[model samples]
Target: MFKNLNQKNNDSIRVEKDSIGKKEIAADSYYGINTIRAQENFNISRQNIHPELVKAISMIKKAAALSNFELGLLDEIKKNAILEACDEMIDSNLAEKLELDAFQGGAGTSTNMMVNEVIANRALEIMGMQKGDYDIIHPNDDVNKGQSTNDVYPTALRIAVLKLLGPLTKSIAKLQEVLQVKEEEFSSIIKLGRTQLQDAVPITLGQEFSAYAEAVNRDRWRLYKITDRLKKINLGGTAIGTGLNTSHSYIFKIAKHLRNFTSLSLSHSENMIDITQNMDIFVEVSGLLKAASVNLNKIASDLRLLASGPTGGIGEIKLPAVQAGSSIMPGKVNPVICEMINQLSIEIICSDQAITMAARDGQLELNAFSPIIAQKLLNMLEMMKKAIDKFNNKCVKDIEVNSDKCKQILDNSLAIITSLVPYIGYEQASDLAKEAVNQDKKLIDFIKEKDIISNSKLDKILKLENMTSPGNNLSE
Candidate 1:
């Protein structure tokens, strides 16, 4: 779908030559010769580069232009042109022109060139020159001055990931808040807790929701902590991090300008060589994402089980009926939201594995697999954010508890004998539990028939609050 969007008429082609050979580029294209070459070479994913990355790259160029102008490296007219062009790229919604695959080779050199060429041609138009007029504003010497794909690609990736984090964190916080609300709403509704799918003890439905809320809170914290790691970028570590062909002043000044432009707490790496060689930070971030996926999968699975059936399964809760569950089965409503979240969690886990392998596969001075890594990571984050939003709005907020079902299950469970242990002794309690189960009688009724304890004392001992908490003495 994206590949066919930005194509120009064949008659409007103009011949443009590069180091290797010549190609016919669309005359109206803001991207020049190198971008066309990459577009032809990597027709793989058929998907355009992410818009967030494009915006981040343009912001980087804008910041670099301002910094270069400040350092006397770029003339006023060229700097203004580059800045205006960067703004155009940033504001434009034409993502289809960015035709390179996300799985490209060369450590994102193709990606960087695409950005540089687009900016250069746009800057040329701003200066009243044709798109291919490199003499007016060269993509290499002017637009990409004092930078290499090595530094720019990773730096833009970091910025883009940071931009994405805002929505992700907001979604997670909202989910946590909704879960907390459910926790409070279900606070007094008693239910039978389970272990290994067997009755264990008594607990309020609110306690279960509270656990989900706590898990989401932990995920939110993990995301917040990892942002600090992403902040330490290698922006000025041009080429192999030696800052070769780039002045020291430009290296420091560019990062400062970027921080001002992005409003992020970004800083240049202290050891450019290490930052250039190691991708451990990305691996760590992926690991945290995997952790969050695990939590979501677990929560979704629990919701599915709890809302399994209204007649056959453990129907302790009822999920919201958003749509029909089946095409043939009448009056069927499935836990589609939970299933969607579960599937998204699995995909995120797989993407994390891909990111891990990519991070580890980096050879020496650069990770050539960074394009794939960036795409998978960003895709997972975006999908998870949307999944969370849908899950919250369509499912979690509308969930209803089966209070009668909960009480019925709790009343029949032999696990209630646990509360009688302190008063009757463990051995006696065990015997009574077996007798109650065998005779198909309520444990409280059997104990009452045997005159084991007064009705009031039994009532106090079997209180839902007492059973769910510790330090509740049976003697009291």
Candidate 2:
């Protein structure tokens, strides 16, 4: 969205120094020297870290500033200035000012520093000072007080993920409800059920939709079940969960303030080392996402087959004609929504492999690879939710049931003979079904020629309700 933002840093530059050396930063930009260094080094992934993450870390900076002020560690003016800057960062597009690529080294230290630098510089503007004037509102001494990148980055990541799950869970529930609505809408339409791609029995289109509804409902609950674990976080573990170079009292103080501030039921971890070093929670999340994608892929594949052809294929259901399918063939319309969903599910499943590998590669102290995990998991959630919303609105809601086509397929299938078991007995039904195939006639017509059963009784046995559902009144 900020692609056209003024990126001409070379036009007017300001000098800033770091531990290693000095570098020139954009004079008009809020980002500082550490950001410039990372911006120059890692340009691999797309520009800008996830904005929600930037907001999360900004919230952390605000929380840290507030807590330090309450503890008498920071003066009120700098605290208020930092707080105002954080509000601006959260509410406005200030995150676009930080121009480093998402994939970077240092276990997200660069990302954390980028946020600190931008917030500090913005706070300097609010405090009537120059951008790089660290003496007034230093990024490290003021904005990032009592916090390390090891603590800030992962904690902010947890907060961002929790925020993202809100929209995604709603998307899942809406999808389930829409599927249920379709289930009820198509409840009485009978169609052939197949196993191994061969006719096996008769089932209603509603029954298939109901199964999809149940699958999606399970997925929603599976994600909801993980929410409590996601709330548990390691905030005070400054470096390696030891709280080294951090105020012990500030540990619990930050947790209390954040819970009241965000209203998210956030908790401080008793075993901060476990939470910091082991990122199994995201792995579990990736697995649930994979399961949901599998269900979606199955539904999309079924739609692809059911909406196969208008003349030469099953044609039992018709998808919404969103756009012209073929460039040359004039009236051709395709199930592009289903096709899009199919491809999206495949992308999600493959991305899950990357998250799992990143989770496993964490060293003894910290998961440096969580930056990739954060990028991958957040992207999956954002993309999946939006796509699922489009699918529900564009594809599922306007779906039309080809009732005539469904009845024709059921009427012509040899599986219809299975309905005659109660009236004619199994052996006789099977034999007549085979004989009907050999005679190249529908089972009903073949039954009439052989006088296997009276028309009245046959009609009752093959009635739409009796074949599609259960408990026929007919008996031999």
lDDT of each: 0.85, 0.86
Model 2: per-residue lDDT, tens digit, 350-408? 88999999999999989998888888888888888998998999999888999999888
lDDT of 1 by residue, 4-48 (tens): 223487467667788898887777777677777777788887776
**Candidate 1: how many backbone clashes?**
0
Clashing pairs in model 2, backbone N/Cα/C closer than 3 A: none
Please identify model 2 stretches exceeding 4 Å from their true place: 1-12, 421-428, 452-458, 473-476
Query: Which 10-residue window in model 1 sums to the lowest lDDT?
Result: 1-10
Predicted model with the maximum TM-score: 1
Candidate 1 regions with alpha-carbon error over 4 angstroms: 1-7
What TM-score fits each model? 0.95, 0.95
